[model samples]
Target: MNSKKILGSILLSLAACIWGGMFVVVKIIVEEIHPIQLVFLRYLVAIVFLILFSIIKKEKWHWNTKDFRLIVWIGIIGNAVSIVAQETGTWLSSAQTGSVITSATPTFMVIFAWLILKEKLTRVKIISVVMATIGVMMIVGIHLTGKHVLEGVLSLVGAAFTWALMSVLVKKVKTYSSLQITIMSTCVAIICLLPFSLNNTTALLKINFFEPKIIFCLLYLGAISTALAFVMWNQGLTMVEASSSGLFFLLQPVIGTLLGWLLLNEDISIGFILGTLLILGSVWVSVKFAD
Candidate 1:
């Protein structure tokens, strides 16, 4: 494999790991703050860091009007819509259901990449996606019983589909630098989210921003998870096939499961071990055999 592809794989994997770790932090903070409020604050801080990073790197922000539409699609589908659907689905359904449903993202990504980008789906890629998906189902488990089963299932499925679409769309953006793409899409997402957040103004004001834990969580989510991770992911997407890069997302659940075991003292079952091994093997095979 070329160095760029290798680097892209590493960066994407690291981003996945960072995001997985954020789940633990998010679980803690969401207990005290509303998810919408947290999302608003998290992206607000993230955009600031992103802007500063762009300034430091001196990355050009210029883009044509046509590119603006691409950014808008990415912002809406990947950030605003996907997040809202995922959060709403998790609220209506169980986390296990949400995780299991969203784990279908790689499968969706492969299909979208094949259909939209005309990317070839080789046998190795297909096998890896299947193995990793089964691993994710094993790790996260699944239970669909709920009052809002249809709504939750549809929302979660939409989230996964839109997210996969966004990953594929990122490949079509050739005019903007990865950093520029991240910033524009993020700015657009924040704009899209603002109207929904306005009603929560009073609750937003009441948040204890001065609390050390809250401050830490905000910075971690904003800088490390959102800003840095998205940049890495976008850059990695540029360097590799979207379908191949999608396989790396499986690392998120593996890392999340391990973090749960270490931090929350969650019990690891035999299924967890088997799932982890399958996921790791899938990633290895996908990266090694990627065309």
Candidate 2:
């Protein structure tokens, strides 16, 4: 059990760190390709690599009817719906607002795990989530006032809720391997986003894929962020209780802020350090002390 938790926590933290730095990659190239189009393309690249990976590992691509639907549920809500909603929310509101609000995703995950999976809401879990969330708020600097705050906030909350629900659902599906679930759901996401990506076909042609930088960024998104990270996250979910799984997500802002400071020359204020400590401390407390 201890070994399992250690391995799961490592995988989960790695996923968070990859995603945390993903913003830097997206920031560099999102202007050339639209968000929906970029999402489609990244997953397209991801699916190919994932398929190759499955083949290499000899991962069985089989699922029963009921489990298939649940896998599809994960893909639609998690990858397709939640991502589009988050894109819309970020568009309609400030990035700062999106960061602050979407950080609530883990909190919602805690709630959903309790409601859907009947996982215990222990005092340690509650306290960890509270401390981590406050750390996020501090790092993001909660400024919710904006032109489309109401609509944006709603979309963001929906994204968080669905994502949380999807995380729990991953644990619910018992038969599929993490690789199997990731591959199947990614296929679903591609189908859902296909029409939207089609609309951006003209824009897609404008991109110079030959440019080393563009190629690198797209590959990073596809291979590192989507393929590797999703597999890690889903596999981690299978090992840990759903309630504890979300605590690892709190590592994102810490990693993101550190990267910003290191790569982007962004200033790290005193609050950033304190918040990082709190968030990291909470994750440690949860992993080390949880029964």
Candidate 3:
């Protein structure tokens, strides 16, 4: 690969690592805070920090009407809606179920690209999707139970669709600087979540800033996960093909599942391991053979 591509890949890999740890952070924070309130605060902190960075860098905050609309759409689908759906799913379902089900993003990406980006639905793509779907089913097949399964499935479906839309939108907006686009979308997310944050003022204010968990989550969310990871992700999206970017995301579930087991002492089963392999294998096929 060229130097730019290699750099983008490394940055994206780093972003994925941070994101893998983020689930653990989110689970911890939600132990005390409501999902809505937690997400609201996370984005609120992210917005403040990003704005500060923008000011320090003397980055232009201005955008034309068209760019503003795209940024708003990105913020809505990628940040606001996707987070709500994922968190709601996590709240309702076991972490295993939520994690496995949400791995269905590539399926939605195929559909969305066909509709929006006019991307091809090749035989390899179809087979890859099937393999990934089957893999996820194998991984969480045991934990799929009760009405929570339905809730988890619904939340995951929403997450898949919304995130897929956001990816396509970002791909379309690749002309802009990744940093500018990241800041713009984060600003929009803050605006979208402002009312919720305002309503939860008492809880937010009462939150002890000195708590190690809270402090860690806030910094992790604001600086590493949201700002830096997104900058890397946008850069990757700009430099790489959409299909390739989509393929790299398959790393998320593998890394997340292993990390969950290690950090949270979550159980690992034969099914999960098998499913993970299948998913990874399918993604490999997609990346290697889907051309």
- Per-residue lDDT of candidate 2, residues 59-160 (tens digit): 766649999999899999998888767656655654445555667878998898989888888999888889888888677675567687788789878877
lDDT of 3 by residue, 1-291 (tens): 567766765666677667766766776677677776777777777777777877888875555777678878999889888977877776666556656766667777777777877878898888877887787677655466667668767986798678777877887773467788888887777788788767868877888989998888888877888888888888877765565456555556666667778887877766777887887787567656755
| lDDT score for residue 244 of model 3 | 49
Prediction 3 TM-score vs. true: 0.87
Candidate 2's C-alpha lDDT?
0.81
**RMSD in angstroms, candidate 1?**
2.1
On residues 167-281, what C-alpha lDDT tens digit does candidate 1 reach at each position?
9999999899888988988898899889878877888888889999999999998899989999999999998889988888778777766676677564444588788889889
Clashes of 1: 0
Ranking by lDDT: 1, 2, 3
lDDT of each: 0.83, 0.81, 0.73
Colliding residue pairs in candidate 1: none
